[model samples]
Target: MALPSTTVADFSGKYVLNKQLSDESKFDDILAAQGVGLLKRKAVGMVSATSDVHVYADEGGVEHLDITAHVSGGFTSKAERLEGRVLNWTDKEIEHPLFGACTTKSKRVLPAEVDAAELQNGWTPECTAAGVIFIQVVPTSGTDWVSKQVWGIEEINGEKRHTRRFLVTTKKNKTVYARLVYDYAGPL
Candidate 1:
């Protein structure tokens, strides 16, 4: 557990998934909604994952964030580098073992900028007051679906936790919502 005084809301640090505190059971359903194959989903669900987050601002005043995902046995599973500027969606290709090729758009936004209720509500008051980071992911092939996720610092069980809420929507209109909570492991 991290001391409350040292936690940063900037979302920079190392965090390990607290499966016991997260709605992890719903992850499979969320993946399915995104058209992930059964075998891959099962493999992902069984592994313990951790995140190494880094947030910074360039000299031009543009903020940036990078998150590297590590799975069990010390293997890096995925990494995403997001720019924190509001603009039209610029689709970029990314490949992941579990998600495969996908296009993503990400930025930092004020609470008021978020129009989706699922992504806007339920943030910790501190984060809601400061701001939030948003990510939109779409598979480049297979069933058409979109996963919109909001990242913020949430106070859970008297501790500040790194939290993410994702809403997955398919072309058929099916949707799945899930929350992932991570325990502060240490500084990155």
Candidate 2:
């Protein structure tokens, strides 16, 4: 199916997480590469987390994204703005079920790349709006991890929903270490 043509302006709303999919066996390698210890990795897998994404454009026409994730016994949030330049910010140290409490400086870039053919295959035109990418420098391990998250709108059972694809790459090899999928449950 051909996706409708859309721009960044179309991604202005709250997207709730409905589902998460990943390869369980590869979780170890993916987590260890980010400096996550064995015990912490196990904890990360046992806990369930729900993420809600909020996107909007500011007065200067810059796209902004705020992702709030609720996990077992705690929650964490990160915000980024895409305005063509690399924006830097410090993410508060938060205990993650998956990564533990590691703090680092985050770099974000807006309007990342999206495959046109992939977008046309049951994905929304708004998927192109998901070009926001984030990079984090791990202080302890000195590993640079990059993440690109995109959202595609699709109709499921006549109900409009959004599917988010998160890809994490290791800067050393530039290989995709992990891929996560999350479905939207309407607004917040």
Candidate 3:
């Protein structure tokens, strides 16, 4: 049965035995008898057919589960850069002790690299076989715009029990932007 779509707050651990699938008697018997390659729900995040059930002789049994699914969606954000350069207030102001004492400086914010090729073609593997759907940043070029800060990925649910992580950064004069996204398929 398909569960309702829900946001995954976090996924990074080994969960205890929950329950075994009881709908398919044949499959259930097979599972109880001989365990399959459990933790195989890396693709769907719900290891329905991949769960293993071990029936103990006396008391409790063992249940190995590995299944999960992701709610399809995206996340986007935007921030204003410092532009070319900021004004040096000290230079325009009267000479005072405060001017000399001022030592703190603002951290420069660089423009996003919204490239055209990236926008059209998308991240080679991020948006394709990898399973990453899309990524678009600011500074999206228009008219005579040079480039943009857009990026995308193609996400893929690999073998069960394996988790996924993606790190983002900016390259320019000074580091100013960063983003991290991840999805845990399930443990086999």
Identify the candidate with maximal lDDT.
Answer: 1
lDDT of 3: 0.22
In candidate 3, what are the lDDT values of residues 9-34, reduced to their tens digit? 11223222222322233323222222
Instruction: Write model 1 residue lDDT over 49-160, tens digit each, in one string.
Output: 8778777766786666677777774445555443233323466677756677888877777656876787787667767777778878888887689898888877778777
* Order of the predicted models by TM-score, top scorer first: 1, 2, 3
TM-score-wise, the better of 2 and 3 is 2
Candidate 2 Cα lDDT to native? 0.46
Deviating ranges (above 4 Å) for candidate 2: 1-20, 73-123, 128-141, 144-174
Window of ten residues with lowest summed lDDT in model 1: 80-89
Candidate 1 residue-wise lDDT at 50: 79
Locate the minimum summed-lDDT window of 10 residues in model 3.
102-111
Candidate 2: minimum summed lDDT over ten consecutive residues — where?
78-87
How many clashes (backbone atoms < 3 Å, residues ≥3 apart in a chain or on different chains) does model 1 have?
0
Model 3 deviation from the true structure expressed as Cα RMSD, one decimal place: 24.2
| After superposition, candidate 3 runs with Cα above 4 Å error | 1-151, 156-172, 182-188
Q: What are the lDDT scores of the predictions, listed in order?
A: 0.74, 0.46, 0.22
- In Å, residue 185's CA in model 1 sits off its true spot by 0.6
